[model samples]
Target: MRNPSLYLLPALIALGANVAVISECQAGGGGELTAAVRHEAELNQISMLEAESLLGQPNVHFFDVNTLEIWAEGYLPGAVFFNVRDWQKLLPAKKDATLVFYCANRLCTASVLAAREVMKLGYTDVRQMPDGVYGWRISGRPVEKP
Candidate 1:
């Protein structure tokens, strides 16, 4: 399924605002993904082990950016379903908390889109777990769906 945010990103990017491109495109987008990966790594990324440890904690927030159908299958406990609505509501309140963004796998750009958006919001402790749900499952961690 195609996320509607993907189509809007390029137009937003053309408006000359770096953040506007991803601000509402946290669901996913396609572009210079290499740059996204590099930047996410430079900004700060989390390992599966670290992310697992933070699950269910109040100070550490998780955002899952995978497709709704995919996410319906399973996701890390306590992870908020990231779309335009939740981001607008929850992110503003917990901007200072440690935020972890993730999608299906390292190749998936959804997480990167989310991380970039959060960073643009001036979040200091943002991190992307590129390995995503795949890594979490392979690591033998449990998954849940709400």
Candidate 2:
């Protein structure tokens, strides 16, 4: 008779491999955000009140990373629409410039992704308004429509 343990070995190996893949993805090898990435993003997040205070500041710039259709509906006052295809050219030349990125709402990850891309490009003052434009609107903040 064949050993029962031998038959289970292949299943265990497959499980191990699956676990490894999940670990790699959570480590930023894939599209998912790793713990480190999320922590770093949290560190750079700004409260709606804080963002409001920064408005009109010379060095502060807001970027709306929502789709063009969503952006056209409304956006934070003075916010520039961030085109993912042409992001590199759209950013401020100064790496230290205060950059605030936002999307539709807390559930939206577009702003986080955009902020990460900017951070990778060596921008030091990257900030994310995770509450996004939805929060801004709910808070009775001004929104401009093009």
Which candidate should be chosen as best, given lDDT against the real structure? 2
Q: For residues 1-146, could you state the per-residue lDDT of candidate 1 as single tens digits? A: 99999999899777768666657564345643343344443558888988878888768888889888878888998888896565757674766889999999988998988888788887888988989998888888898987
State each model's CA lDDT, in order.
0.82, 0.89
**Candidate 1: TM-score?**
0.67
Worst 10 residues of 1 by lDDT: 32-41
Candidate 2 has a TM-score of 0.71
Q: What does candidate 2's lDDT look like per residue over 1-146, in tens digits?
A: 99999999999999999999987654445575644434444439999998999999998999999999889889999999996687888889999999999999999999998999899888999999999998998888889999
Which portions of model 2 miss their true places by more than 4 Å?
A: 1-43
Off by over 4 Å in 1: 1-41
Clashes of each: 0, 0
